[model samples]
Target: MKQICAFLVIILLTSCEYFNVKKTSSEAILNEELETFNWNDVDEYPSFSSCDSVSSKQEKKQCFTDILTGHIFEYLQDEIIIVTQDINDTIDLKLQISNTGEITLLESDVDSLTVKEIPNINDLLVRSLDTLPKIFPAIKRGQQVTTEFKLPIIIGVD
Candidate 1:
């Protein structure tokens, strides 16, 4: 009878261990150790915490740094133009926009980049920002730090 009682006691004690819903420190440690660290996420894009609420100019500057660091522009392959037309009526044309605000009509791959455009379009630059003119004029904090941009376009000969 004593042997059966001791066996029942052992079973009860072992079964109680399964009822533990609380996460132990040791368990957390083990889980963290087992998880594989994602280096690419760190090396590639900026984290939400780091990139969030970029309201101030300083924050924008930091965001720009993170953007360039991540090389987010590397994969951006913007087509100059997209047209669906018959070969007999189709023609090839090329256009380019420079940060200098120049709406250049480029004929050759090698062209001068020093020539300045009208409004001096720079980073996040566009030829005619319909929204920008209505929203924010020239963003001047301390001094003018000119940034450059390039946009290419292709048009049909017809």
Candidate 2:
């Protein structure tokens, strides 16, 4: 009887330990999630209403780009630009789309020659953006997020 009782006590202790669950602190869980989270990528790119219907991610991005470029081109075409010298250059336009869907021009990288030929190039670009349709901000982890874009605008005039 004594030996049986000792064996039962040992079994009870072992069974209790087996049922024990390790408690994880909230900080540790949060840290682990942060480590696995990607900061640079967005789940969905910013889009205009016209681009919202697209299903594929790549196609949505392409649609947004096409619409933006088309609007800028149309706006520029409407204006009569006169340059004495033949101008052919590309402007790297840096833009920021806020989480609230507002567009802002961060900067414009214009060559010295291009700047000289088109003094108001920056103004024109800004004005062109002002004419853009209502934009839907980018999405990351199901939350609206601000995003930056570098768009190349080609300027060719004979």
Among these predictions, the greatest lDDT belongs to: 2
Q: Estimate, for each residue in 1-158, the C-alpha lDDT of model 1 and write its tens digit.
A: 99999999999999998998975798788778658643222222222234446666556545644443233222212323222432121111133323232333333222122112211212212222212111111122332222322323221211
lDDT digits (tens) for residues 70-126 of candidate 2: 899899899888898998898898999999999999999999988888899899999
Mark the regions of model 2 whose C-alpha exceeds 4 Å error after superposition: 1-22
lDDT of 1: 0.34
lDDT of 2: 0.92
Q: What residue pairs clash in candidate 1, if any at all?
A: 80-154, 99-149, 100-117
Candidate 1: residue 92 Cα off by (Å): 35
TM-score of each: 0.21, 0.84
